[model samples]
Target: MLKVTAIAAALLLSGPALAQHAHGAQKGPNGGPMEDVAGVHAELVVSGQTVAVNVFDEAGKPVDTKGYTGSVMVVSGGDRKTLQLTASGNALTGQAPGPVQSGAAITVVVKTAAGKSGQAKFSAP
Candidate 1:
């Protein structure tokens, strides 16, 4: 019983280290911050009043946007706006009601055709 308790404690202690490894440092191909979502990478790029979210696989290859639906919430200058994204080639694009400035906080949530879903947070670049 003591051995089992020690093993359990060790496992619990290593959980955070393992999780950090799984989501370790990632860089977007478009010079933006990248994050893992639903086992894939989501890169966010914002310009003027348009925001583009490009999805890529673990290997950094663009993923097909077929049947993918998503939304982006951008907060800038103390104003928050939510924009519906539509599939466009390998990326999803949306036009915000107002200009999305650099360093704006953003949250993206997506649902794939396969029923997989995930959300990621980023700062507009």
Candidate 2:
């Protein structure tokens, strides 16, 4: 019983470390942060008034987002905005109603053409 209890505790402690090794964070080609979402990599890129999410496969190659849908929820201070994204080229692009706050955290939700869906948050750095 003691051996079994010890083994269980070890497994619980190592579970997250194993998962992190399997899907480590990556840097996307667009110079943005990449995060795992629904077995794919979602890169968040912001430029001027445009917000984009570039999708990539596990191999780090660009994935065609022809039918992928995405949205971004940004919260800064007391303001919150949810922007709808449109599939275009290799990314989902949206226009922010105003400038995104530097301290704001953004969360992206994506559904691929193959119907895989996931959401992840990108904290301000």
Candidate 3:
């Protein structure tokens, strides 16, 4: 009974980690790849000519839209538009200068507190 209890506790402790590892890179709330950095959760979403991002705190609460900057490079009509993003609420939203057609590819570069930078890629549907 003692050995069984110890094994069960160990399995319980390792279960979450195993699940995370199995999922590898999982999608965030907005259906984009999410990477956890330090205490922040960053996600990227691409739709039409707009690429939106939402940042959340460690406790899954949305963070303020301040002190965070991002740039998006989206390919549309054989051209690329590099737009600077503006933060609103917990999201960073931006519009490409030109019309972004379907099946476009987007790359986002984000900088947060302490000048930490991260990148995410997305394909429009």
Candidate 4:
């Protein structure tokens, strides 16, 4: 029935497994790929063992992240790890379990202090 279908759609969109993967965004000021996440832009940067996500507004200007929390899910070959991020300066930062493998795929998920959530994905360079 229509009611059942609507309920299912709502649940699907609100579930943890539902991530709006934005892949067509241009590179950001930090030389990382930027994607529209929630109501802002998120740039994913991986260097050494650090995974950082820079948040920006729709205009690509850096934004404040004082109350934002985020995490990075890195997958390379058969290895996978989730890094819990901490807001540092104006970016959300986390430490990977090991060196980020070449050609890995990264997904950055973030939530504001008010509980607004969004996500962005990146392909390793």
Candidate 1 least-lDDT 10 residues: 18-27
lDDT for each residue of candidate 4 in 24-77, tens digit (9 for 90 to 100): 757888888888777788888888898889888766688889999988889998
Q: Write the per-residue lDDT of candidate 1 for residues 1-125, one digit (tens) a residue.
A: 99999999999999997675244345677876777777678888887898888988867899999999999999888799999999988798999987888888899998887889989888776
Model 2 Cα lDDT, one tens digit per residue, 33-118: 78888778888888766788888887788888888898999888888889999999878889999877665789999988889899
lDDT of 3 by residue, 9-101 (tens): 999999897656222267777777766543467676766667777888766688886888888788766787788999888988998765566
Cα misplacement distance, residue 86 of candidate 4 (Å): 0.4
lDDT of 1: 0.84
**TM-score pick, better of 2 and 3:** 2
Instruction: Go through the candidates in order and give each one's C-alpha lDDT.
Output: 0.84, 0.83, 0.73, 0.83
The positional error of residue 94 in candidate 2, measured at the CA in angstroms, is 0.5
Q: Give the poorly placed runs of model 1, Cα more than 4 Å off.
A: 1-9, 20-25
Clashes of each: 0, 0, 0, 0
lDDT of 4 at 66: 91
Instruction: Quote the lDDT for 10 in model 3.
Output: 99
Give the worst 10-residue stretch by lDDT in candidate 4: 16-25
Error of 2 at 124 (Å): 4.4
Q: Give the lDDT ranking, best first.
A: 1, 4, 2, 3
